[model samples]
Target: MGCDGGTIPKRHELVKGPKKVEQVDKNAALIARWNYCAISQRPLRKPIVACELGRLYNKDVVIEYLLDTSPEKCIIETAAHIKNLKDVKELNLTDNPAWKGDKVNTKGDKYEDLQGAAFICPVVGLEMNGRQKFCYLRDCGCVFSERAMKEIKTEVCHKCGKPFKEDDVIILNGNKEEIADLQRKMEERKLKAKLLKKAKKSKAIESCVKSARTEANALSSSSSSTSTTGGKAEKPGKPVSGIAK
Candidate 1:
């Protein structure tokens, strides 16, 4: 109902109360913390915070969406750093029997999934202008949003054959480039290790040469002392204190 001021009374105002301030939820706070660590290069804290936060269902959803979206045999982060428990936890999100393939109307589907779904990817709860907009990663097999696809020059994803725009799409070929770079780095490291090993061996050989020279000097000194004693031994039978000459 309108007040005498001609403005409609809020639901709480009619009830003689003030609206409560919305606070960030605990799960979201945990996820935010994890993301902060990832961006900050402090993944060492990930396990501790993950243990404390237990599990985030939404995080699982995002992971699954990433896996389904990527053309490669998708694993989280880097392949060599895979931890079994972590991966299992991530992959199990799709196993939620409660989903039943229903339309993800959490807020609303923004993009049209012409290939398969309107929104197959899970939503990341990011807020803007007092409203939450979920972010999703598109699959390589699918076309970008009709409007987004119109603006780009790329015809298709090189890895998965999905059509895309130059801007809306992330190319999977960059990952291959990264892999190649890593391989080159590894080769360089191996070469460095081999050189260090050779240097160590050379140092040991040099030490051995010095020790051999010292041993030869000691042997020569011992032989000279023996000769001096032999020269002085001639008078031993004649007198105990007599000189050898």
Candidate 2:
């Protein structure tokens, strides 16, 4: 039979084939991670903070999420790990001189460089764009490129001179393996803190019990001494009264 309007239908179109796999745009994903806040979905601003899992967020949004007791479900899921300001470190980012603000292409006629980053590594001067590996120090919140860290190894922060250990360095927007490692470290740290708190609480309870026992013993001893003294004193006075009768 002839097709409608004399249009020939291809065999591939008539017979359904296997569906093509949907792929995510790498550039868009990178922009989302590097340029936007994970919680509020707003553009990243100063006072940016990162969680233990290496998710970047604006400090104000994170604080708002923490303070809101009845937050939206998505906000809860996104920032549930952030209990307080202590859970996140405020990053000390260096401004990229070449990066014109996002307003540079407001007209939309000009070609915008997706790779332009607002911040860069203070140590190696590498842009904080998603192309390069970046890490922040938990101790001082100083950010540096992974290359600079490997090339110049030191116990103290390169930017702030604050001391930090190898464990204090947390990768920003890491891969699956790196994220899994970070999760494990986070769990271990939390477990250690919980155990320490429990130990301190037990110690305080033990001290209170010990003090209570000591006070009871002291009261009992004082009462026993007073009773013994009172029991021996009335015999002479009773004999004098009986002789007079």
lDDT of the candidates, in the order given:
0.38, 0.88
lDDT of 1 by residue, 159-217 (tens): 35555543323221123564465346445655787899999999999999999999999
**Candidate 1 TM-score, true structure as reference:** 0.27
- Residues forming the 10-long window of minimal summed lDDT in candidate 1: 127-136
lDDT score of residue 83 within candidate 2 = 83
lDDT accuracy of residue 147 in candidate 2: 96
lDDT by residue for model 2 (73-105), tens: 455565778888999999988999898765545
Question: Per-candidate TM vs. native?
Answer: 0.27, 0.83
Query: For model 2, which pairs clash?
Result: none
User: What value does the lDDT take at residue 238 in candidate 2?
Assistant: 39
- What is candidate 1's CA lDDT for residue 191? 78
Candidate 1 residues lying further than 4 Å off, grouped into runs, are 1-44, 47-174, 232-245
Model 2 / residue 57 / CA error / Å: 0.5
Strongest candidate by TM-score: 2
